[model samples]
Target: MFLKRITIQNFRGIQEMELNLAQPSGNRKQTLIIGENGTGKTNLLRAVALVMGGSDALAELLNTPDDWISFGAPFCQLSATLLTQAGEERSIQLTINRGDTLKGIVLANQDQLAEIDAALAHATQNYFVVGYGSLRRLNRSTGFSRGGETIFRQARATNVATLFNQEALLNPLNTWAMEVDYRTNGKGLDIIRQSLNDFLPAVKFHSIDKEKGHLIFLYGSTQVPLHLLSDGYQNMIGWLGDLLYRISSAFNDYQSPLKAHGLLLIDEIDLHLHPKWQRKVLDYIRHKLPNLQLIATTHSPLLAQQAQEHELYALKRTSRGKIALEAFRGTPDRLLLHQLLLSPIFDLETDESLAVEELKKQYESLKRRKDPPQGKLHYLATQIEQLPQNQRSNMNYGNDQLDLLREIKSELKARRDS
Candidate 1:
C-alpha cells in the first residue's frame, strides 16, 4: 500500500496541512520531511502512522486523546488516501472526540452501512504502514519474549504508541538469526545480509555466529559483534535490520521483498549517521526499494541535498501556535550544500557567524565604493585576523575566510585611489 496523499487537521501542534506524495510521470520516490526541532515533523508522521497502522487499539491503549487533539479544539481528524497494489484508491478518516472521549473510524468518501465493515477491516492492515521514531534503539533481547504483533493499535493509536510506547525498542537481528539459523535458508536473515552487504562494505557483515548468539561482521581481520561496533554503525544497522525483517515478513512470497510496496516512515533518518553517509543513504534506499514509499524527517542539509524534485517538504511552526507544511520546489540535488542549507528546505538565511556576517556586510559596502576610505582596508584585515581559527573557514567565504579577506585587503591597499 502506497500512501498517496494526506491532510491533517487540528492534530497536535499542526492546525492544518495537506501533502501529495506522488512523483512526476507516475514514478515512485521517497519523501523527505525537513524541519527544525519541535516543528511538527514527528507529529505529521505520527498522525499518518496512527491512522494507517490501525488506531482502534492504539487510541485506547494510549489513553491520551487530549494530548493528540489540538489545544482548544474538541476533536482532531486525520484524512488520508491509500493507493493499493491493484490501483484502487481508498479514503479513510480517523477522528478523536474530546467531549465524548472516544476514537472513531469511518469511510471518508462513502455513505453506506455495508461498506463500514469492509472499510474497518481494510483500515487496520489492508494498507500497511510501519514506522520508526527518532530514537530507534533496538534492544538486544534474545529471549524471544519481547512484545510482537499484539503491541505498538493491535499498535498505531495516533502514533503515541509508536513514538512513546516504552516497549518500542525492537528485538536485535541476532535473535531473529538464531531463530531461523540454517532452517529454511535462515528465514529471511540472509535477505538483510545479502541485500546490504555490498551496499555497506564498510561493515563487512559476512556471517552470523549462530552458536554464540551474536551477529558477526569482519572489521578488517577482526570479528566484531554488533554490540562492539561503533554507535554510528550500531544505531544505523540495528534499526535497518529490524526494518528489513518487518518488510520481509509483510511481503512474504512476493516477487522481491525489497521491491514490495508499503509506507516506511523513519523519523530523523540522519540519526547517528555521519554527514558523509547522510548524503547518500536516502538515495541508496530509494534505489534499492523504489516501490516502498519512504516518509522520513531529517535536519541535515547533507541529507536534504539528496532530495529530488517534488520530494522535499518542510514543517514550519507559525506565529499563531500552529504548524504549516511547505513543499520545496525544484531539484534540491542540483544545489550546492550551502545553497541547500540557505534554501527554504533548511530556512537558513546565512551559514555564517554573526561576527563574520557583520564583517561581510561592511566589506561589501567598502568594496562597492569607488574612492578613498583611508586605512579601512587595514581595519577590515585586523577584524578578520581577530576571528577564531575554527570560525575562519566557516565564514561562508572561499577556501579560507582569512585568505579571502587578505585578498581584499591587498587589492584595496594597492588601489591608486586609496
Candidate 2:
C-alpha cells in the first residue's frame, strides 16, 4: 500500500496544505519535505500518523485535544488518498474538534471508512503503514524479555515513543535479535548486518553477543557493543535495526524481508546522522526497498540535494503568516550548497552579514554617482571579495577535481534536457 497524497488543514501550525506524495509513474514514490524550525514539519508528520493510525495515533502523539488542533482554530482535519494493494485508490478523512472527545476517529465517508477500517482492523495483512519519530537512542541492551509479537504492535512501539516515552524503549533489538537469528539460522542477522554496513562507512554489525545482552559491531579495528558506540552509531543502528525487525517479522517467510512494500512515515530522517552518511540515507534505503513509499522531513541540504524535483516539497510561511507546502522545481541534484539554500525552496534572502550588505549598497551607490569616490569603492570591493559567494566564484579546486566537475556538469546538462 502507498499514500498517494495528503491534505492537512487546521492542524497544529498548518492552516491548509496539500501534497501529492505518489504519482502514477510509481517510481516517484519517495518524497522529502524540508522547512525551517517550527514550520510544522513535525506536525505534518504527526497529522499523517493520525490519519493512518487514527485515534491510536492521536493517543500516541498528543495529550491535549484542544492543543492538538491549531490554536484559535475550531478543529483539525486530515485527509489522505491511499493506494491499496489491489491498485485501488481510496480517499479517507477524519477530524478532531476543539470540544469533541478524541477517543476513536469517525470518518466522513462510510464506504471509504469501511475499506480503511477493515484494513486497519486486520493490521497484519492487505496494506502496511508505520510511523517513526526522530528520537532514536540505544542507551542499554538489558531488560527486554524474549517473545513473539506482530508487526502492528512493533511499529507503534517504535513510532513516537523514542522521543516522547523513554520507558517504551527496552532493548528492542536485543529483545528480538536472538530469536530471529535462531529462527532464520543466522540469515536474519546477516540481512541486518549487510544493511547497516552498507550505509555506514566504518562501523559494521558483525554479530550479537548473547552473553553481552546487546548487538556487537566492528568499529574501525576494534569491536564494541551497541551502547558503547557513539550517539550517531547508536541512533542509526537503533532506528534502522528496529525497522528491519518490524518489517522482517511481517514478511518472515520471504528470503529478504526488505522486499515487503508499504508506506513508511519517518520524522527527521536525518536525525543524529553524519553528513556523509546522511547524504546517502534516502538513496540507500530506496535502492534496497524500491517499492516502499517514504515520506519524511529534514533540514539537511545534502539530503535534499539527492531528491528529484517531483520528490521535493518545501514548507514555508506565506506573506500572510500561514504555512504552505511548496513544490520545488528543476534539477536540484546539481546545485551547489549555497545555491540550494538560496533557491525558491529555502528562500534564504542572504547569508552574508548586514555589514557586508551595507558595503554592497555603498559600492553600488558610489558607482552610480557622477564622481564616484575611488578610495571607498576600492575598500568595498576588498570586503566583497571576502564574501562567500565571491569566494566560490573565484575558487580553484586543483587539477584532481576537474574530472569530477566535468562529470557533474555533463549529468546536470542531461537532467536539464529531460
Candidate 3:
C-alpha cells in the first residue's frame, strides 16, 4: 500500500501542511517530498511516524504546537490516508496539545501525549517505516517479543524446516553464516547484484566480516575501505543496504500483498557524493527501481535540477521559525534545472540574451591577453578559427576583435596549411 495524502497542523516547525501523492489509475505509488534541510522535510517523515505510531524520538524532537506557533495556540493535528495493495483505505488522525506543564516546567499537553502514543501504534500495525538512526533498534527488536519468543515464529520455522529437508541446517550456526555470506557475496540477489555491478563494478559487500564490512569501491584499480573511502561512497552504501533490506523484508512477508508498494525517504541525499554522482544516482534509482517510490531532500542545485518541477518542494523559513514548502517557480525542464544548479562550474545560463552578452565579454577579455603557450584561450582560438564565416559572425565576439582574431587565426591557419 502507499500513502495517498498527508495533512498536518502545528507539527514541529510547520504551522499547517497538506501533501498529496500522484495516484495514476494503474500505478498508485509513494509520494515524493522534496525540500532543503530544516524545511520540515524530516519533520514530515516524523509526522508520518507519529500518525502511524507515536515514536518517542519524534515526540522529543518536534516541539508541540505552542512551541512552534504563537503563544496561546491550542493543539496540533496530523492525518494521513493510505491506499493498500488490496485496495483498502486506511486513515490515521493525531492531535497533540501544544502547551502544558510537566510538574512546573512547560511541556506538551495530554492530547499531544495521546497522539504520540496512537501514532506509534498505527505505525507498528501498518507501514514498515525505517529511519536512519533506528535501524539497529529495528534489527534487534523486529523478530523478537518482550517475552523472548520469536514474533515471526511460523515463518522462521517454515524456513528452518525447508533447510533441514535440504540438509542445509546440519550445523545451524554455520548454515546461518553461509546463508548471509551467499547473500552478501552477490549470489542470491539477482536484481540488486546486477544493478550494483552495472553502476559500481568495483564495490562489494563482505557479509562474513564481523562488522558487516564492505569493500572500498575500486574505480580503475583504486581500492579504499569503508573507513578510508569518501563520505559520499559511505552514504551510498548505507542507502543501498537499506533499500535491499527493506525490499527483502517486504518480499518475505507472505501475508502482505501490499509488499509491492515501497516508499523510501532520504534526508540530505546529496551528502558526501560528488556532483557527478548526485546526478547519476538519482537517474539510476528512477530507472532501476521503477516500482519503488523515492523521495529525498538535497541542497545541491545539481540534484534539484534533475528533479521534475512537480517533484520539487522548495522550503523557506519564516522569522517565527516556521517553515513553508512550495513548488519552485519558473524552473525550466529537468535538465535545465540541473545545469542551472551547476552554473557556477559550467557557466550555463537560462537567459539566452544574458548568456550571449557574457560570452562576448569573455571573448573580448581573452583576446586582450597575451596568448598563453597552453590553456583554454589557445584552445578557444583554435576552435573559433575552424568555424565557417557565417558561424563565426554568429559568435559573441565584436567586429574589431573578430577581425584581429581572424589575423591571428590566419597565422595559425598558415602554420597548419603549411
- Which predicted model would earn the best lDDT? 2
How high is the CA lDDT of each candidate model?
A: 0.67, 0.68, 0.48
Candidate 1 lDDT (Cα, 0 to 1)? 0.67
Per-residue C-alpha lDDT of model 2 across residues 235-321, encoded as one tens digit per residue: 775666566666666656425766778777778898888899888898887887777788899888888988876888899888899
TM-score (C-alpha) between model 2 and the true structure? 0.79
Count of steric clashes across candidates, in order? 4, 0, 13
Candidate 3 local lDDT, 1-418, one digit each (tens): 5667778887665787787665345443323344545577766765665454333333333333345442445776777776766877666565556444322112333353453345335643235443331111112121111110132122222111211122211111112222334555644433334435544434643222334333334555655544455455545554454444434443543222223345555556666677777777666767666655665666666676666546666556767867766654444243554344433322234323564445545655776778844466556666555544453322443466457556757767776798
Better of 2 and 3 by lDDT: 2
TM-score of 3: 0.55
- Arrange candidates by lDDT, highest first: which order? 2, 1, 3
Q: Ten residues in a row with the worst lDDT in model 3?
A: 140-149
Model 1: per-residue Cα lDDT over 1-418, one tens digit each: 6677888988886888898887666735688998888888888888777666443445454356578888888878877777767788777667766654443333322232223236446644345556777776576656553323435425333223345554566656665554445435665556656656754547787677766677788889998887888887877776666655555454443124566666788888898888778887887788777777888999888898998888888888777866788888888998878767766667667677787888867866785689748488557756765665464332354454557756765665676365
TM-score of each: 0.81, 0.79, 0.55
- Compared with the true structure, the alpha-carbon lDDT of candidate 2 equals 0.68
